[model samples]
Target: MAQIGMEQIGVVERVWRYPIKSVGGESLRQADVDERGLVGDRVYAVRDARGKLGSGKNSRRFTRMDGLLHLSSRLLSDADEPVLLDVDGTAVPDANGFLRSYLNQDDVELAREGEISHFDELPVSVLTTATLDWVRAAVPDVPVDERRFRPNLLVRTPPGCPPFLEDGWPGRAARIGNVRLTFVRSCVRCVMVNADQPTLPHSSDVLRTIAAGHDNCLGTLATVAAPGAITVGDTVALESQDAL
Candidate 1:
C-alpha cells in the first residue's frame, strides 16, 4: 500500500447561505448537506423583468447591486426577521421588499425565483482565511471580507498552502465525515468584492490582488459527491482516489 499524507486544519467557523442572490444571505449555526449542496442554499435568485437572471455583471450599472449587500444565514438570526439590511438602515422581509429597496426605480420590474437559486455555474464555493489574509496584505487599501467572496465553505489552513490550492486537487476528493465534495474550478470574482458591505462606495484593487496571487484559475468551486451533514468543528480529510 502506498502511504498517503493528510493534514487537518482549523474547523469551519461559520456557515452562510444566500437565500436570494444579490438580496442577502442568512447565517446558520448548522445546516444539512445534500447531493445538490447545502440545504436552503442558493435556492433563490433575483430575476429582471425579462425573466432573465440579474447579477453583479450587468446590474453593476445600477448602484443598487453595487450599493446593497447580503450575507449568509449563519451571520443572522430569526429575531432579525426581514434579515436583509442595507447600509442606510433599510430592511426587507421577502423578495418583494428586496427588489424595491435594491432596484430603487419603482417601475424597474423585478421578481424572485424560489425554485432554484444557483450561483454563476458552480454548485459549491470555498475559500480560506489564509488566502484572504494574503490578499489583504497584497492590497492594504482593499478590505477583503468573506462576504465579498461569498463562498459556501471557508476553510482555514496553514499559512503557505496556496489559498486556492484546491484547483490542483481536481479529480481528487475531500471528505468531512461521510460527506464528500469534489473540487471543480476556481471561483471568478467581480466588482461585488469591491462593494462595501454596509456602504455604497466601491473599493478598487480587490480583484487585482486575487489575480496577482490566487488566480490559480479563478476561485474555488466544488460539488457534493456524498450526502452528509457538516458543522463548524468537523475535521476534513483530502484523499486521492488513485491510491485506493
Candidate 2:
C-alpha cells in the first residue's frame, strides 16, 4: 500500500452548519465538534406525510420538494423552537403551517432528526479551495462559491496543489485543531448543487461539468474521530490511523 504521511494541507477557511436539512446554512467563526458532527448541524428536517424528509432531490430518505431552497431555518429559544425565515429575515410564525402552504402539501411539517439521519450521507461534509478553483476553471461562467457546495469545513489548501485533492483522502484520518476526522468517502454531486440560493442562481452547467470531468463527485464526507472545538483558522492535517 502507498504510505500516508502527516501533511499540512491548509487551515479551515470557513465553517458552516445547517440547522435544518437542505435549507440555508449558518456560518460560524468557531464550532464545537462532536460525534454527530459540528454541534446542531442538520439537527432538524422537514418531513412529508409519507415520512420522507424534504430535500432538493428525491430518494428513499428524501422527497424532492420545491421552495425549501427559497426559505431558511434557524434554531432559536435555546433550540427548543426552530423557525423558518424568509428573504426579509422575518420568521414565519408557524413553521409547519408555512411549510404546508409553501410546499403545497397538507402534511408537511418541520421535524427534528430522530432515529433517521437528516444528512444526505455522512456526518461532516468537507471541501477545499483546490476543488472550488477547479470548478471555476472548468466552468468559468458558473459561480464557484462554496455556498454552491455546502460543507461543514472549507479548507484553504496550499498553493501549487492540483484540483480535487480531497478525492485521495478516503480511508485516511485528518486533524483540524483539537478535532480528528476519518474521511469516509468522496461526496457525490446531486441536484442540490443546482438549486438557487440568496445570491447563487440555479445553473445546470455546474453539475454537467462535474459529471463530465470529475465523475460527479466533489469534497469528502468524514466522521469525527476525536471531538473538540475548531475555529476558522484551525490547521488541517492528514495522516494514517496509527498517527491518531
Candidate 3:
C-alpha cells in the first residue's frame, strides 16, 4: 500500500554501474543496491605508479590519464573480477597488459577499491529527465545526456516536472523499489562529464552550459539507507523529513 505522505516523484528510467572508474559504464534493467551504491560498481580502477587512480581529470586521488574513457570493464563474476573491453566492445584477455598498451603507460594496475572509497562524494548519484530537459533547452545546439552525468540511477519525471527537481531532495528520503536512499546534496560535476565516451564526442559546451547557470551542479547524490534491489520502471517515492 502506498504511504499517505509519500509523493511519487518519478520512475526509474535506467540503472548503471561503472565497474571501473572514469570508463564507460554498463546499463542494466535491474541492479542490487548496497552501501557502496551498487554491488559491483567501482570495485576496480586503473592505478598508476604514483598511486593516483585513472580519471579524465587530475586530482590528488585521481590522475588525468587520457584514453581511459575509451575503455570499460564488466564484472565477470560475484568475485568482482572485471573484464576489460575496448571501445569496440571486444574484451581484452590480459587486463593489465591491455591497460599498458591502451593507456601507453607502465606500472598501471587494475586495482580494487582499498580502504578509501572510489566514489567522488556519495555512494550513489541520481539524475532526473527534468534536469536533462533543462540542459537541452539551455544548449539545444549541443548534446546533453544522462550518461554524461554518470548517474547510478536515472529517474524519469513526468512531462511537466521542473528542471533540477532533485535539488530540493536533500534532508529527505526516497524509496526506489526495494531500496531506500537518503538524499545528500546536489552533485558537483567535473571535467569528466565532458570526456568522450564510445559514441559521445568530446565537448566542453556541455559542462560550460551547466556552469553558466547551475553552479556546475547537475544531478544529486545519495547514500543507500536500506540496501536492496531496484529495477527499471520502479517508482521513486519521496518522504519529506521536515513534514514528519
Candidate 4:
C-alpha cells in the first residue's frame, strides 16, 4: 500500500456557522464540533409545500425566494432559538411572516430540524484561500466572495503553493485544532454560488468558471471523526494514511 505523508498545510483563518440554511451566516471565533459538524450550524431551514427543504437547487422555490439571503439569523441564549433579523438589523419575532414576506411565498414555513438538521450533502464543508484566489484569477469579471461558497472553515494555505491543492484530499484525514475530520468528496458547485450576496449582483460566470476550470467543484466535504472545539488560527494538518 502507498503511504500518505502528512504535513502542516495551513491555519484556520475563519470559522462560520449558519443557524438557518440558505440565509446569511455568522462568523465565530470558536465553535464546538461534533458528529453533525459545528454546533448550531444549519439547525433550521424553510420547508416548502412538498416537504422539501428550501434550497438553491430547487430554483423554482429558492430562485423566486432568493431574498432569504438578505436576512440574517442568529441563535440566542441557551434555548438556541433562531432569531431572524432584517437587512436593517431590526428583530423579526415572527419568523414565518418574515420569511413569507421576504420570499413572497405563502406555502413556505420556517421550522427547526432538531438535532440532525437538514444538509444538502455532508455535515461540514471546508475551503482554502488558495482555491478562492484561483477562482478569482480564473474569472476576473465576477466578484468572488467567500460568502458565495458558504464554507464552514476557511483555511489559509501555506505560502507558495498551487491552487486547488485540496482537490486531492479525498479519503484523507485532517486535524484542525483538537478535532479530526475525514474528507468525503469534492463539494459540487450549485446555483447558490451564482446567487447575489448583499451588495454583489448575481454573476453566472462564477459557477461557469468553476465548472470550466475545476470540474464544478471548489471545496471538500468532510465529516467529524472526533468531537472537540476549534477556533480561528488553529493549525491544520493532514494525517498520514499509514498512521491509520
Candidate 5:
C-alpha cells in the first residue's frame, strides 16, 4: 500500500440535527456524536398507514410537500415532545394536527417508538463548503442553502482545494476531535434539493445542475467508527485515503 500523508483538511463550520424526518432542522453549536450520528438527529419520523417513513424521497406522501421544510422542529418539552414551529416562528402545540393539516393527509402519524433512526441512507451526512459553492456556481439562478441538502456536519475545506472533491472520498475515514467517521457512499441527489425552504416551491434547475455536473451526487454518507463530542471549529482530518 502507498503511504498516505495526514493534513488538516478543514474545521467544522456548522452542525445540524433533524429530530423528525421530513421536517426542518435545528442548528447547533455542539453535539454529542454516536454511532447513529449527532444525537437526536432523525430520531423520529412521520409514518403513513403503510408504515412508510415520511420523506421527500418517498415521492408518494411527501413529494411536493416542501411545506414541511418551512416548519422547524426542535426538542422543547422533552425528547417525546419535539416542538414544530411555523414560518412565523409560532410554536405548534399539536404536531400531528399541524402536520396533518399542512400535508392535507389524514392517514399519517408521528412515531418514535424505537432506537432505530429513520435515516434514508447512512447515519451521518457530511458536506463541505467547497462542494456547496460548486453547486451554487453550477446553478447560479437557484439558491443553494445547506439546509436544502440536510447535512449533519458542514466542513470548510482547506483553502484552494477543488470543489466536489469529496466525491472521491467514499471508503475513507475522517477524524473530528475524538470522533472517527468512515465515509460509506456518495449521497445521491434528489428533488428534495430543488425545493425552496422559505417558499416551499420546487425548482427543477437545482437537481438538473447536480445531474449535469456531478452525476446526481454530492456530499457523502458516513458511519461512526469512534464516538465523541464534536463542536464547531474542531479540526477535521482524513484518517484513511482508500479508493471510493
Candidate 6:
C-alpha cells in the first residue's frame, strides 16, 4: 500500500450543476455518481435556432450566461420527485421552462443537438477548504463560495498546500465508501465564475485573481474510478499509487 497523507478529510459541502449548458445551476446535499458523471449533471443543454452549441465561450456576445442559471439531477427527494432549483429558489418546473423565462424565446432553441441527456464534463469536481481559505487570505475582497467554482465535492483538507494540489494526486485515489475518484486535470477558470449566485450582480476581478494566483480557480477535475452513492460525513480515504 502506498503511504498517504496522515490526516483524514470528508466531504463538507457540494454545489452547482449545469443542467443545461450556460444557464445556471442548483446546490445539492448529496448526489449519485456514474461513468458519465454525477447523475443528471449536464443532462439538458440549450441551443440556438441554428443548432449551434450555446455556451458562455461564444454566445456571451448575444446571451449573458451569467444572467441565468441551469441545474438538474437524477437524485430525487423523499417524495421521489426531481430536485430542481432556479435562480429564484428550489422550485422550477424544468430546465427548458427555466431558460424560457430567464432568456427570451428568441434565444432558447430546441434543447441543443449533440447534447447528451446524461452528459457531464467530469465524473466529479472537488475543492478543498484549505484552498478556499488560502484564496480568501490572498484576496480578501472577493467573495469565495460554492457558486464561484461550482464543485460537486468540497473537502476540508489541511491548509497551506498549493492551490489544486489534487492535480498532482495521481496513483492516489480518493474513496468515499465504495466510490473512488481519480484526480484528473486542473480546471481552467472562466467568466462563469464571476456570475452571482442568485439575482445578485456579477463581481469583477475575482477570476483575474484566480487566474493570476491560482490556476484559474478550477481546483481539480476528477474521474470516477468506482461508482457508488456518496453522502456527507462519509469517511474519505486516499490511496497512493506508484505513478506519483
Task: State how far residue 149 of model 4 sits from its true place (Å).
Answer: 0.5
Expressed as tens digits, the lDDT of each residue in 1-106 for candidate 6 is 3225522454455544555555456566666778767666655556656554555445423334434443333334453334445544566655556666766665
Compose the digit string of candidate 5's lDDT tens values, residues 1-244: 2226544678999999888877888888888998778888877777777767776665543434446777788875355657778878788888788878878999776788375547777999999999998877877777677987899999998778898767767778877888988888999988888776775356798888889888899899999989999999988877655422
For model 2, what is the error of residue 237's alpha carbon versus the real structure, in angstroms, after optimal superposition? 1.2
**Candidates arranged by TM-score, highest first:** 3, 2, 4, 5, 1, 6
Estimate the TM-score for candidate 4.
0.92
**Candidate 2 residue-pair clash tally:** 0
For model 4, how does the per-residue alpha-carbon lDDT over 41-160 read when each residue is reduced to its tens digit? 998888878766776666533434567777778877576778888987677979888788788788888778855448878999999999999988877888786899999999999777
Stretches of candidate 5 above 4 Å error?
A: 1-5, 59-66, 113-117, 199-201, 240-244
- lDDT, ranked from best to worst: 3, 2, 4, 5, 1, 6
Which 10 consecutive residues of model 2 have the lowest summed lDDT? 73-82
Each model's C-alpha lDDT?
A: 0.61, 0.85, 0.87, 0.84, 0.80, 0.60
Candidate 6, poorest ten consecutive residues by summed lDDT: 112-121
lDDT of 1 by residue, 171-232 (tens): 66777756788877667776667666643236767766666666523447888988888787
Where model 2 places Cα greater than 4 Å from the true spot, the runs are 1-5, 240-244
- List ranges where model 1 is wrong by over 4 Å: 1-10, 59-64, 70-83, 86-94, 107-117, 159-162, 199-201, 216-218, 241-244
Q: What is the lDDT of residue 120 in candidate 5?
A: 72
**Candidate of highest TM-score:** 3
Candidate 3, residue 24: lDDT: 83
TM-score of 6: 0.76
Estimate candidate 3's RMSD in Å.
1.4
Model 3 residue 38 CA deviation (Å) reads 0.8
